[model samples]
Target chain A: EPEVTQTPSHQVTQMGQEVILRCVPISNHLYFYWYRQILGQKVEFLVSFYNNEISEKSEIFDDQFSVERPDGSNFTLKIRSTKLEDSAMYFCANPEGVGYGYTFGSGTRLTVV
Target chain B: AQTVTQSQPEMSVQEAETVTLSCTYDTSESNYYLFWYKQPPSRQMILVIRQEAYKQQNATENRFSVNFQKAAKSFSLKISDSQLGDTAMYFCAFMRPSGTYKYIFGTGTRLKVLA
Candidate 1:
């Protein structure tokens, strides 16, 4: 079966450094999203993208965070300056564009020191 | 706002036994979607099963099935003949039926299958 794939399975960065987590969603899907899960915490929504633009976002998706569909298959999340609290597993998910079930990627584990 | 709650933080079952994981949600919108996802140690999210709020009939996939109660706003997953590979963190999620519906996931129920 076709599955979403993310690059950099694990990443470690300094608290003030920048990091980019990437994902390639299923080809036919239309909607894309980013969610973060702090260790032992609930996954929180960050942002959702479609038509190369942000559709909706949560409070947690603040100025420090941004998402880009730089290319047809590539969706990325960039953190301008990482914070220690930013450490968490970032998941990329896609829904059946028009409307439907969600399928998530393996996740990129971001660790800030 | 939609919230999914998975009461049991953890559960254990024998390899061949049956196990039920409970889930509940708060949503007044008559149209929506309920889902159960499995996240293994690899942290890969896998879609297990889904139910449409409007459909009274529950959804089942092989040994994995769900008991969806629309009136009570409850959706539980039942795994029959569980196997060692069934061990994982099970998450119950909710989404709007149409429009821009992002998923709201529960903390998750960790299941350990003992042989």
Candidate 2:
């Protein structure tokens, strides 16, 4: 089965440093999303992208965060300056089809010191 | 706005037994989708099953089945003949049929299938 691929399985960075998490969604998928789960907390939606632009974003997706479909297959999420609270497991996902289901990547664990 | 709630934080079932995880949501829109996702210790999100709000028939996949009550706004997952591998955190999610396709997930129910 085709799966979403996310780079940097685990990352550790200083609180003020920048980090870029990358994902390659399923080739035929039209929608892409970023979700984060703080330890012991529910997974929260950060942003959704389509047609080369952000379709919607949650309150957690603030100025410090940004997402890009830099190219045909690569979708990336960048954090300008990480905060200690930013530590979480970030997952990239895309729907199998319109409301059919969603396939999620293994997730990039971001740890900010 | 949509909110999914999984009231049970943790549950355990003996191997080969049946277990059900409960989920409820609040949504005014009649058209939407409900889902149950599994997250093991590896922390990978896996789609288990899905139900379209308009469909009254529940969805089932092998040993995984769901009891979807549209009137009560409830969607519950039932795992039959549970195996040790079934141990994981189960999340119930909600999504609007149109617009951004953003998903709202519940806090999750941690299920342990004991050997």
Candidate 3:
């Protein structure tokens, strides 16, 4: 099975630093998404991207956050200025298609100190 | 807005036995998709099973199956012949066939398979 790959399984950074998370979605997938799960909490949607543009984003996806397909195969999320509250496991996903379910990456654990 | 609820915070079952996890959702959309995902100690989210609202027949895959009641807004997962590998945090999720492609997930149910 094709898998979504996320780099930097774990990352620790200063509270005010900038961080970039990378993901390589399934080769044939058209839609990509970013979600975060705080410790012991529900997974929350952050944003969705397709056709090299952001399709939609949740309120949690604010000015501090931005996503880019940068290339045909790589999707990246950049947090301009991280806050302590930014500590969480961020997952990149590819639904593959409209009716298919999501295939999530192993996740990048961002630890903002 | 759609919300998925997994009422059971935690559950335990003996190895080789069977167990069921309950899930319910609130959605006004007539057509949508439901899914059950498992997150093991590795914290990797894995897709366990999925069901389409338009299909009255339940969906099953290997040892995992789902009881989907569209009218009641209920979707439950049944694990038969459970194994230690089945111990994980199970989450129920909802998504509509729209442009956003965002998935709304439940708080999660932690299941323990004991020997």
Which candidate gets the maximum lDDT versus the true structure?
Answer: 2
What tens-digit string does per-residue lDDT give for candidate 1 at A1-28? 6688888999999999999999999886
TM-score of chain A as modeled in candidate 1: 0.93
Per-residue alpha-carbon lDDT of model 1 for B1-115, expressed as tens digits? 8889999999999999999999999998998888898988888888899888889999999999999999899999999999999999999989886655688999999999999
| Regions more than 4 Å wrong, model 1 | A97-100
Query: Which model scores highest in TM-score?
Result: 2
Candidate models: Cα lDDT each = 0.89, 0.94, 0.92
lDDT of 2 by residue, A4-65 (tens): 99999999999999999999999967688999999889999999888777888999999999
| Stretches of model 3 off by over 4 angstroms after superposition | none
Q: Where is model 2 more than 4 Å wrong at Cα?
A: none
* Per-candidate clash tally: 0, 0, 0
Candidate 1: residue pairs that collide: none
Error of 2 at A62 (Å): 0.6
C-alpha RMSD of each candidate structure in angstroms: 1.4, 0.9, 1.1
lDDT of 1 at B15: 94
User: How close is every model to the real structure, measured as TM-score?
Assistant: 0.95, 0.98, 0.97
DockQ for each model: 0.65, 0.91, 0.84
Give lDDT tens digits, candidate 3, residues B19-109.
9999999999999999999999999998899889999999999999999999999999999999999999999999998868689999999
C-alpha lDDT (0 to 100) for residue B62 of candidate 2: 100
